[model samples]
Target: MGVTLLTGASTGIGRSLARRLAARGEAMALVARRGELLDSLVIEIEQAGGQALALPCDVTDRDALARALASAEAELGPVTRLVANAGGGEPTFVDGFDSAAFEAVIQLNLIGVANSVAAVLPGMLARGDGHLVATGSLAGRRGLPSAAAYSAAKGGLANLMDSLRIDLRGRGVAVTLLMPGFVRKHEPKPGRGKTGRRRSKPFRVDLEYATARMEKAILARRRQLVFPLSLAVAIGLTRLLPFGLDARLLAGRGRRRPAAAQPPRTRL
Candidate 1:
């Protein structure tokens, strides 16, 4: 198998996908901001007889990401597959409207993907064979009340991937978009508080299952993949409802109080 470069490989869905690819004996370069986590994951993969390189860099920094990609190519051979998956989002508060925070989210979630693509596209185009995959979200399908920034970022990402798919067609580079909903990192422990309970997200799927489905899509070169059929159906149904009624329904659903502002965790 050709070497695959995966961003956000330190945690959550990125980690899961790396593990799955490693198990299949695909050589990989794991990229993330957390050097320690990348090192640990590299160790685990190597111990299991997989070839992997730990590349610690922020995807938001184009120069740093480009350097990391060069290092991976030197060690593992040219990266024939690129997973542009590093992203996170803070809730956008209409009351406060922090433009800085909104801009940061867009930079990380959308521009970060663009950076990853820039790092690999030249090499892929030269070779005339490669795959580019990105993680989008079902939330991108429509705007959510409290998650305006996040929804916008994801929606923009989905469109970006779609445009790439069209442009790259017949160019020997395939683009795939993974649209997942509510992937739970871990199950919440019992007996926290109402606040903790409210923090818990719904329609969650375990990492293993999500990874498996993602792998299948990547291997099949699917143009778009949306998981957890139930959530997809629900989101689809909402589109058919009357605009006023749908708006009211969304309004009736309570939103969690905004937490203190902080950078979103660098994970998908």
Candidate 2:
């Protein structure tokens, strides 16, 4: 819709991004499983003098995503930007994982992103101007003991976008992979966050900080943006570690120590 299309707008970072973009007066199309939530966001955006269309659709549905884009075009204008953010935090365990949740994560986090990209690319290519962004996580660069599926999906998305970036580089389309380090949400208590020395055992990130990061990347049209340098470096190192040591570290196996008692905040 003129500038942006957002998926996974029901809550968390997606919702925050939507609000921020609206405040900046960008036209948008919001998608999520909950039409009710999109409705509420649409009301807020419109009242703030921004144009938006709420196209409730599951990001995993290839055809549905394409149809929603058409609707967004008809209602607003050309789609100039897209946030492929529909995702799931799944398989939240080691051996105790749920097969269904694991599968669903791949479908939503990986294939869903693919669907969103496919839906918008044709028009963007024709116009020769557009930006495609996908919300990835630091976890994408490493496998956490419990978040196997999530890590896999996000990692897959990063790889997928890498190739897409190459294919579209000279086509006048831009691709950005935003890797955030656990941005906390107002709700979702597990991520609300605390402060100081204990340093919020949970995944700690402030909304403003994340929004600023996204704003810069979106404006500059950068590629493969990672955040919180410390976490970024850690994940990068994980790839170079010997498999045994890496496995032990990630699984929380015997390693001397309290330093990691709180564990790394690698959650989605």
Compare the candidates by TM-score and give the number of the best one. Answer: 1
Give the C-alpha lDDT of model 1: 0.86
Residue 131 in candidate 1, Cα distance off native in Å: 0.2
Best by lDDT: 1
- Cα-based lDDT at residue 240, candidate 2: 85
Q: List lDDT for all candidates, in order.
A: 0.86, 0.80
For residue 154, give model 1's deviation from the true position in Å: 0.7
In order of appearance, the predictions have TM-scores of: 0.93, 0.86
lDDT of 1 by residue, 154-235 (tens): 9999999999999998999999999998786776666532356554454678878888899999888899999788888887
Which residue pairs clash within candidate 2? none
What does each candidate score in C-alpha RMSD?
2.3, 5.1
* lDDT score of residue 80 within candidate 2: 93
The 10-residue segment with the lowest total lDDT in model 2:
253-262
Record all residue pairs in model 1 with backbone atoms less than 3 Å apart, i.e. clashing: none
